[model samples]
Structure formats: structure tokens, C-alpha cells
Target: MLAALHLIFPPRCIGCGGAVTDDFGLCAACWRETDFISGLVCDKCGVPLPGKNEGRAELCDECLTIARPWDRGRAAILYRDTGRRLVLALKHGDRLDLVPPLGAWLARAAEPILLPDMLVAPVPLHRWRLLKRRYNQAALLSGALARAAGLDHCPDLLARPRPTPSQEGRGREARFANMADAIQVARRRQGQIMGRPVLIVDDVMTSGATLAAAADACLAAGAASVSVAVLARVAKEG
Candidate 1:
């Protein structure tokens, strides 16, 4: 029966649409193609680098220059070619099945550093953006991570108070300025999130502005701490 089903509806790779078995939704070739970030990573933000000694440096140059509101952050992959495509597909392509594997990756990457009392919340998109996109990618990712980690995932707690310019092609400082004050913790859910450690989830982290702004809002609302988990991180240079 299963064989007949496969014949009727052949399984295709999520990454490259090639034939594959039922594992991670990616064919072997596509899986091998992914440049998973490993090796030396920034202590405050997980940006993997080469050289064993690099990890001992304590902080990345960028993070050293500026202090972020969030305690720290981590990511599973580097935001390059294949990583970019996978994130776009999961967000704009309506491939919700990718959530589980992506979520599991996030959980694994974050497990060692995660706070025991963390409550998960996705960085909210503005209502207009949400309407255009049809779904919140961060929320979906957060939900999956929460299930895997056994933490509280709250979708309605944080909201974009206003729409901001696209951070793409913007300078880091500009992006930070653009996102500051763009988010607000929902008054109704404020009680539920306050006094709890919060982990903000996002599909990607580029300038670190979005997460920082979100963390600021969470802290302002009385959250004890705010950390971040992203599926991918844009390279420091771009």
C-alpha cells in the first residue's frame, strides 16, 4: 500500500525537488549541499568561523562594539545560497512541513545555552506585512521549537506596533534605528509573559536590529531576560 502511494505521489526533496526517502524532506545530495555552520562560533552570537583558536576569542568584533539588549543568541545555519533558499521556501513558499526539521535544528543548536524558564515568542511582523505574507514564519518556527523544547510558545504576546522600512540593504545602525519602537508587548498577554525569561525566534538574523528591538520591548514589558534563536545568520560581512 505504501509502495503504491509512493508510485502515485512520488516523494521529492524539499531543497532541490529530487527523488528521496522519507528523511528530513531533503534528498541526500541536497542535504550534503547544505553548509551547516560549525567550528568556532561567537559566544554572544553564534556566527561560526574557521580555526579552533577563533572560538576562544570570547566575542565577535561586531558584538564587542555594541551591546545588545538580549542576553545572547544562536543560529543553526549560515544565511548563504542554499540557506537563503530554504528559508524563503519555508516562509513564502508555504512549505510548512519544513518546520519540524528546522525547529529540531534550532532546538539542538540552542539546547546547551537555553534558560530553563524561557518562554518562546516570535518577533512579530506588522499587520500589513502579515496580511501580505499570509503567515508569520517566525511564529511557525517558534511553535515547532516550543514543542521540541517543551517551552511556552506565545504567538499573540508581541505585536508590531508599526510598519518599518525593509532592513535589506540598510546599514546596521540604520536598521536598528528603523526597528526601535516598532514592537510592543500585547497588553492582554503582558501578565503572562512578564517576569519570565523569553527566547525570541526568527527565521533569519541579519543586522541583529530586529531581535534587539524585540528584546527591548520584551524587557520593557518586564521580561527577566531575552535571548534569540534564528534558523540562519547572515554573514558579518554580507
Candidate 2:
């Protein structure tokens, strides 16, 4: 029956829509174009170090200059070319089939951050935005990641009370304020999340303003610690 279905709908690459052997598989060209992160990365922010220090852990300059609220963060890929296409497809194009592959990458990226007792949650979208989109991409990513990592997943651990505009062109201060004003602890779920180390999942990390805001709420709610795992990291500057 599955093979019959495959005959009806053949597997194709997520990035370029070329034929492939399995769902979520990228074609050779797309895979080559994708930039998977490796080597030494900032211990705090997860961006790659510009220098040759590949084995040692260290802080990025941003973390050195400004304190970050989350304990640590990691991303599987750099957001460009194929990576960006996959993220956009999941986020805006309703490519739910990409979950397994993206989830696999997230699992690998988050390996160093995982702890046996840590609770998992997604950085949430406002109700209006959720209604329009019909599904929260972050929630889906978090669910898959939690399952893969054998951790407890909580979809309603956080909430966004009001909607905000896109953060595309916004500066750091504005983006921080927007997310700070939007994200909060889900009222009834606070006690369950309290005192637990939390891992917040998202599809992508841009300026990291959203993650920081989510971390703030987690810490304020008495979470022992907070970390982040993203499928991709935006490397370009505004």
C-alpha cells in the first residue's frame, strides 16, 4: 500500500522539487548547496568561530559583550540556499513532510544540550497568527524533536498574548521589545514547568531576539535553566 502511494506520489527533494528516493531527501545539488554547521561554535550562541579553534569551547563576541539569558543554544544548519528553502517550506508552504528530516537534524544539533530530565517547549505564535497559519511550525518541530530525544514535550508551556509584526527589518531593541511583550508563560502550565530545565525549540534562529524573550519568561517562571535548539541559524546581518 505504501509503495502504491509512492507510485502515485513520488519522493522529491524539499529544496528544488527534484526527484529523490525518499521523502525529505534532498537532491545532490541541493544537498551540496546546503551549509551544515560543524567544528567549534560559540558555546553560548552556537555560531561558528571565525578562528581556527575547532575543538575548544568558547563564547562568541556577542555573548561576551552582552549577557544572554539562555544557558546555551545550537542550530543544525546555516540559513542559506537549501537550508533557507527547507525552513521556508516548513514555515510558509505547509511542507509538513519535511518534519522528519528537519527533526533529525534538530536532534543531532541538540544532542549536546539534552539532559535526561529537561522539559521541551516551542517558542509560540500568537492566536491570530496561529489561526491564519493553521499550525505553529515551532510546535511541530518541538514535538518531533522531543520524541526523537526521549524528552517530555509541552506544547502549551508558553503563550503569546498579542500579535506583532514581522521582525525582518527591525533592530535589536525593537525585536526584543516585541517578543518580550508578546511571549509569556501559559497560565495553567506554569507550575508544571517551574523548577525544570527547559529546552525551547524553534524552526530558525535569526537575531535570537525571540529565543531570548522566551528564555526570560522561562526563568521568571522559576525554570532551573533554559536552552534553545533551532533547525537553522540566519547568518546574514540586517
Candidate 3:
């Protein structure tokens, strides 16, 4: 039945809408266009390193100057062109079909950072936003990631109790302020929260404020550690 369905609607390249070998498979041209993040990167944030390595787990200039609450982060791709398009499609284009490939990418990106028995969760959506969107994309991504990474997932474990203004165009300070007190660990999950490392999943990470707020809440709830994984990361401007 599945093969028959595939015959009826054969898989096509996500990047170019051209025919591909299998579902979520990129054609040669699309494959070349995809920018996977790799090589030396900032030890903490996972931003790709430029010229040469400074040291193992070398901190980027931003990391040197500013501190992040999460102990580590990983992103599958730099947010641009193909990568950005994939994320936006999943976030707003109702591309539910993209979840599996994106989730797999996230799992691979997180392979080095994933820890045993760590609780996994999506950065929460405000009720109003959730209502409008009709689905929490992050929850879907986190669910797939938790399964692939062998971690326990509880989508309701973290939440946004209220709506916050859009983060776009906000300065770093403004973004932090807007996200302050935004994420809460559920009271029922107190036992799960305490002493357990947690991983927050997201679609794209720009300023990192949202994940920081989520990590702050998790730590405040007595979580032993916090980290983040994302489908894409907005590259630092030079």
C-alpha cells in the first residue's frame, strides 16, 4: 500500500520540487545547495568556526564576552537559503511531512551532546499562539527527537504561561527582557525536573533568548543541567 501510494505521488526534492529517490531525499542540485554546519565550532553555541582552531571547546568571541545559561547547543544547519526555507515551511507552510527528516537532522546534530536519561521538550508556545497555529511544531519536532535520541519526552512539561511580543527586530537586551519569566516547568513534573538534565528543542534559534529563558526556568526548577538543539541557527554576522 505504501509503495502504491509512492507510485501515485512519487517523492520529490524538497529544495527544488524535482524527482528524488525517496521521500525527503534531496536531488543533486539541492544537495549541493544545502549548507550543513560542520568542522570546528564554538564550544558552547555550535556556531561554525572561521579560520583556525584556538583550542578544544574554544569559546567564540560572543561566548567570551557574554554568558549563556545552557551548557551546550547544536544546530543541523546554518539558517540560510535552503535551510531557512525548510524551517519556514515547517513553521508556517504546514509541511508536516518535513518533520521526520528535520527530526533526524536534529538528532544527528545533537548526537555528541545528548545525554542518557535527559528529559527532552519543546520550547513552549503561548496559548494564543498555539490557538492560532493549531499545532505546536516544536512539540512535533521534540517528540520525534526524543524517540530518535532515546530520551523521555513530555511536551507539557514546559510552558509559556502568557503571550510575549514578537522577538523580531528586538535588540538582544530587549529579547531577553521579553523572554524573562516566559517558560515554566510544570508543577507536576517537579520530581522529573529536579536533578535531571534537560534538552530544549526548537525550529530556529536567532538571538538565543527563548532557549535561555527556558533553560533559566528549568534550572530554577532544580534541573541538573540544560542544553538546546535546533534545526537551524542564524549564523553570526561578520
Candidate 4:
């Protein structure tokens, strides 16, 4: 039945626009083009780096400058053309069929760091932004991950109160300032989050500001610890 549906609809890969046999949302060739992030990476930021030299030595220049509140981060891929195109299509094009595969990739990337008693939440968008986008990609990612991991996912644990302008071209400090206090713990869901370890989800991590802010909000709400899981990490050089 699934194969017949694929034949009828002829789902094409987001990367190459060629036919996809499986539900991975990518063609075989495009799947090979999807580079997984590997080698040395910052213990905190998940940014790839040269092979190990010493203790915490390969921390990206950005990670060296700014302290992130989350305990750690995991990213399945480096954000380049392939990752960027995939993420954009998933977000703007209503390609939600990509969620399961994307979540599975994130789960695998994050498995080594997985901790017991983790609660999952997504970085929320402001009501205005959510309305405009018609959906929150992060939430979909979070829900899928939680289901796959057997973790509890609370989609409404946090609420975005303000609509900051786009973070495009914004410096790290500006992004932090823009998101400050823009998120508040949903008072109604306080019981579910208080004193629990949180795994915050997002489609990508760029400057680390958004995830940091979300972690801070969770901590303030009494979360024991906060970790981040993202589909891709925007490479500093790219």
C-alpha cells in the first residue's frame, strides 16, 4: 500500500527533486549527499572541529566566547546547502512527512548523551509567528522525538510572549537580547516541568542564543537540567 501510494504520488527528494523509494524524504543519491556531523565537536555546542588534541580544546571560537546555559547539544548534520534546503522545505513547504526521519536522525545523534527522566519541549514561537507559519516545526520535531525515545513531551510547557524581529544578521548579543523574557513557563504546566531534566528541540541551532534562552526559561521554572537537540548545527564557516 505504501509503495503504491509512493507510485501514485511519486514523492520526490527535497535535495535532488528525484524520486524517493523509502519514506526518508530523500533519494538514495541525496541521502549520500547528506553529510553527518562528526569528528571532534564542542562539548556544549555540537559544532564540528578538527580531530581531538586535548581536553575541551576544540571548542568552536563562538563557544569559547559565550557560555550556553544548556548542559549540552546534539546535532545530526552540519547546516550547509543540503541541511538548509531540507529544513526550509520542512518549514515553509508543509513537508511534515519529513518529521519522522528527521526525528530518528536526531535520536541517533543524541543517543550517546541520553539521560533518564528527560522531558522534551520545543522552543516555542510567539502566537503571531505561529499563526503566520501555520505550524511550529520545532514542536513537530519534538513530538516525534519524544515518541521515539519514550520520553514525555509537553508542547505547551513554554509560551512565547513577544514577537521579536527576525534574527537574521543579528549578532549573538542581539539574539540573546531579543529572546530575553520573550518566553515564559506556562503556569498551567508547571507541575510537569518542575525539577525535571529538559531536552529542548529545534530544527537548527545558529548562534545558540535561542536554545540558551529556552533553557534558561526551563531552568527558571525549576528544571533540574536542560539539554538541546537540533536537526542541524549551522557551521560557522559555512
Best candidate according to TM-score: 3
Question: Candidate 3 regions off by >4 Å?
Answer: 1-5, 51-55
Candidate 2: tens digits of C-alpha lDDT, residues 82-111: 899889999999999889889888889889
Q: Which stretches of candidate 2 lie over 4 Å from their true place?
A: 1-9, 51-56
CA-only RMSD, every prediction: 2.2, 2.1, 1.8, 2.4
Model 4 root mean square deviation, Cα atoms: 2.4
lDDT of 4 by residue, 38-93 (tens): 76777777777777636553567787788888888888888776777788888898
Model 4 stretches astray by more than 4 angstroms = 1-11, 52-58
The global C-alpha lDDT for each of the candidates, from Candidate 1 onward, is 0.84, 0.87, 0.87, 0.83
- All candidates: TM-score: 0.91, 0.92, 0.94, 0.90
Candidate 2 TM-score versus the reference: 0.92
Candidate 1 has its poorest 10 consecutive residues by lDDT at 49-58
Model 1 residue 110 lDDT score = 74
Q: lDDT per residue, candidate 3, 18-83, as tens digits?
A: 999898888888788778988777766777887676556766777787789999888889888788
lDDT of 1: 0.84
Residue 6 lDDT in model 4?
79
